[model samples]
Target: MRRLLLASCIALASLSGCASMGGASSSDIAAVLASPSRSADDRQRDARDKPAEVLALAKFKRGDTVADILAGGGYYSEILSGIVGPDGKVLLVNNPGYDAFGKKGYTERLANNRLPNVTHVVGPSDALGIGEGVLDGAVIVMSYHDLYWVDDKMGWPKVDAGRFLDQVVRALKPGGVLLVVDHSAKQGTGSAAAQDLHRIDEQFAIADFRRHGLQWEAAIPVLRNADDDRSKNVFDPAIRGKTDRFVHLYRKP
Candidate 1:
């Protein structure tokens, strides 16, 4: 039944001439952000995250089945729920490590089935349990660096980056969009800074996705902070919410 509904939605999106590059409108983003159900904390973060611009770059549309990968605390998951609407579905995926770190936030966010269209899925990093060719889009916000991060004490295992990306790529239908947003490391640093500064080189991330067969689409610059030198840990108080970030959009072709 769910698959049937999703198929219908996909068909409708096709018939409507949905563009592979951009579809979200300013009003569409405004309506989602204006929702009263959003928590105050998320609203506060908006000033720094500039979610409106980020969502505009994603171009997610009504009835799109999207996934919020490594959805810590369901922040993006909740907002995605509003964008996708009741006809659409949002997969809030998290591995045990992320779940353990964000239990309280996601717990309260999901309590009483607040987000009816969002399905919280807890699974291993290598296999996120999403069916192949099932998603219209997927977003990895501030968590892609975790693929290269390893801390046994923190319960975050060394993720097989290639295998992990393969799962996300396989889940998207041809022409599906993948949006990645993460803190930027110094040029050429690659994934070396992922564990230490919780950052990844923007070029490395683009190349990583391209290697997995995803076409690099756009690099939105709304979140870039010129002041960040990319030297401090992302959690450092001086740059916690003000890090220089990179937003890249890709397509499965």
Candidate 2:
């Protein structure tokens, strides 16, 4: 009995290790991160950046529809529009807080590029109005932290993770993808730094979505730095713009 228990524990440990370390080759990841248009610092920070592969894994077709939650600067949105081709659509969803950076200038920049497939939608942090059961995928890149912040003084209400997931689930077609990438908070911390430093606990994110009927398809620690202590805010001078992050891909049931 003792031997059987020991062997089972060993197997479980090995499986856990495999789960965290799996997915995409280092070379494939390197190519995306090394694109010339991206800054050297950004490239270096995300050594295993593979946004294209993430889209592909979601089965995004040439003409499929996509929603970019928190499409700040339209970086990924632009790339997605090009990939989806002229026939597809890319909704650039931005929260009210993001408008502090100026919408006119942002629109002008994207207009110069003449990306016909992309459209901008502005609204509250928690809700995005696209459509029901039509999107191929919705990618939230480093922006879900805002959901934790609404105007309490104005009775704006707190972020209910359950309601938020239901909204995304309703927006996506059956088996559609929900890809999330954000700065990784420390394990067991349970979203403590999300409000303070704009980072989130990846474990909490996975569990929260799962509770809302989303299945955890896979997780890739493409840009993890196990050394980060999470003691300092993500924007602290020491870790600002270079915090370790986790990239997770989940699917609606």
Candidate 3:
């Protein structure tokens, strides 16, 4: 309970910082929501995938180079490409396991679309293939916890989350923002349970990032809910696809 209050205070401070920056206009929101490269189904998927209101609140700017870490299926990759425009680049971080999961069909789709600004990377589990101090910002959406799944079968030679985060920190420019969103789990819940439940305890995540020199930025209830019991698996029919989630943003200090 004490920890929860502390987190609440930290979130309020971050919200104040965000409020100091000007918010996006409705027209800008429409432009992102209506991007032609995104299919109708893709746009609909964005609602649950990226969530426009949340992205807008993130204040991602045009001409800002960005990285979409763990870019599964390239859903957020497409939206980010549109947001960054032609001058800015978007690197899609694709691990070998992800490539195997998506197969050659994923490669063909990108080739057919011809997104010149988008680049696909296949690199070590610890490091993204981007140069240092080049990125403006990076986002890991519902995929950060997968770092825990790195094993021989996953083609990840190592399973060290610390090493993985070190690589992420190295890839970013000084003061670069790293926004993470994942399913919220209960307190004291460890990684083993997180894997079974497909959710992570928010406090554990914050502490892990802090250990890596990341400053707590914001915690938004934009997708939060108190109803989830965290007892069921994420794929369970009841709360599988519709679990209450949290969006936490962090920045390199």
Ranked candidates (TM-score, high to low): 1, 3, 2
lDDT, candidate 1, 47-128, per-residue tens = 8998878977878877889999998798888777766666789998998898888899999988987667889898899988
Candidates' RMSD to native:
5.9, 13.5, 10.4
Candidate 2's residue-wise lDDT over 1-253, tens digit each? 4564355334333332322343223333333334334444444434345564554445454566888876766666755654455566888877665644436545753664455678887766557577689887888888766566555564445777566668777888887888888888777777767766677888888987788778989876656776777677877888776678777788887
* Most accurate candidate by TM-score: 1
Cα-based TM-score, every candidate = 0.90, 0.74, 0.82
The clash number for model 1 is 0
TM-score winner between candidates 1 and 3: 1
- Location of the lowest summed lDDT over 10 successive residues in candidate 1: 12-21
lDDT of 3: 0.68
Regions of model 2 farther than 4 Å from truth: 1-59, 102-105, 150-157
Give the poorly placed runs of model 3, Cα more than 4 Å off.
Answer: 1-27, 150-158
Full ranking by lDDT: 1, 3, 2
lDDT of 3 by residue, 66-169 (tens): 88887766767766665665555788887766656655545754775456778888776666577777777788887777766535655655457898787787
Candidate 3: minimum summed lDDT over ten consecutive residues — where?
Answer: 11-20
